[model samples]
Target: MSNPTELTHAPHRDDVGARMGMWLFLFTELLLFGGLFLVYAVYRHEYYSQFRVAALELNLSIGALNTVILLTSSLTVALSIGALQKGQKHLSVMLLLITDILALAFMVNKYFEWSTKIHHGIYPGSEHLLNLPDGQILFYGLYYIMTGLHALYIIIGLVFLTIVLGFVITGSVNKDSYVKLENAGLYWHLVDLIWIFLFPLFYLIQ
Candidate 1:
């Protein structure tokens, strides 16, 4: 049988390993987005005018509102972790719940935004899009691909946050052992960071 003392130390090692693993996973995500950004840059250089026109068709107000939502959600995640570290479990859970709400708000806003676009026949592979010039077609193509991927990431992050919230409530993550919460926070931040890049590239281009 394993020594009781050794068993006690096992979680410490596991915590370190978990953190390293999360970082590795996030690094891979960055690579994926980096490649997409490079593609966007290449195409934008060739179709700057078309890209600008397509961007103008996007609703800046909705994009800006989603940006604020994600930024606020990131803040709540940070605060949740801090609250847990300070042994305020209830407060931590509350903050995490707030983060979840903000995430859902972002998604709902995106839903409406996408619906509006699609209603106007502005989505990928639509007849209207295909009828456009090559440059304009490429612009909408990248916009959908990038923003759609970002929205998927947000959903994934929401799942992670929800799971971590349960762990926190059940004491699986606590002040003494909160590696799981930290990992979830890292993932959420990555989701937010990707959007920070996406919002500018797709919505605020000159």
Candidate 2:
């Protein structure tokens, strides 16, 4: 006959292991973005003057607004995790919902920015860009690629946070088992951090 106490005490999941795995995944993501930044730096150094001109075409107001939106979202997500830890389920869910809404707002702002650029005949393969000086062309090219990739990351973060919200509602990620939400928050913060780097590089540069 099996001992009931031993059966009850058996380990079901390793929260530590799960967190370690999440950190490993985040490290890989960092490496990917680091490589992209390296390319941007090399190209920008080669074409500093033209890069400044290309940057002027970007709307600093819109970029700053998006930066505020992302930073606010990061705060909400962090607060949500804190709420969940304190066993405040409703508050946690509401904070997460706000985070998701902020993410959507960021995307909307990005859409308008891109639309304006495209309307001005400024895209990756537009003849307008091609005919520009080589330095300007390279600047615009890197700008589009980096910003596009960051926007994709925001979309992905929204989807992941939505799933985590669902989990929280179902009580699967409550105070005792909040690893899922924690991991999701980590991902969102990463997206925000990348934008912090991007905003200054592409917008505030003189």
Candidate 3:
């Protein structure tokens, strides 16, 4: 593949339908996350003390760090899309690389945070649980379910972006036809937005 800098042009899609489709999908994603937030709202209110303790036990710093990582990645991806729309090929590719590294940072932090929780017997079906009260168990259960589902979705979103980033890196996207990169950025922003709410609800609310 030629160096991205060698290509000075980029392609922008003029398709109204494509843009509309992306927006519609984003709306659907918002609804899905809204449902999860509703579930958290209901459960946390029901088990306030236990949930508070659970939240305190959570790695707030990790969540905060990941939040910044994802947010910065979103900016880079947005900038990449801008570069394409502006016909700047090299800038788009470099932005994509930056976004990927940010994504990697986010995922690595999640790994360390989850592993720490696992070591403390926080995972479901763990044989060495500390045997807390029923309310605490319920708190942990909700915490795991809500956060687990969110994290799973994040992983899937990252995989989709990895594919798009590869397209950029390999020159398939190049200086033209970068619609896929923009779409991928949209999805990544959705992932970041979900975490924004999750962080406040799970950590700050307590």
Candidate achieving the largest TM-score: 2
User: Residue 66 lDDT in model 3?
Assistant: 85
Q: Which stretches of candidate 3 lie over 4 Å from their true place?
A: 1-14, 127-130, 170-176
Off by over 4 Å in 1: 1-12
TM-score of each: 0.94, 0.94, 0.84
What would the per-residue lDDT of candidate 3 be over residues 78-172, giving only the tens digit for each residue? 99889877878788878878887887888788889889999887887666544776556766676677777777877777788789878877778
Question: Candidate 2, after superposition: displacement of residue 194 in Å?
Answer: 0.6
Best-fitting candidate, scored by lDDT:
2
Least accurate 10 contiguous residues by lDDT in model 3:
5-14
Better of 1 and 3 by lDDT: 1
- In candidate 1, which residue pairs clash? none
lDDT of 1 by residue, 1-206 (tens): 56454765653346778999999999999999999999999999998999998889999999999999999999999999999999999999999999999999999999999999999999889999999888889988888898899999999999999998999989978887898999999999999999988999899986
The per-prediction CA RMSD against the true structure, in angstroms, equals 2.8, 3.2, 6.0
In model 2, how many backbone clashes occur? 0
What clash count does candidate 1 reach? 0
Error of 3 at 102 (Å): 1.2
Q: Order the candidates by lDDT, highest first — what do you get?
A: 2, 1, 3
Q: C-alpha displacement of 168 in model 3, angstroms?
A: 2.9
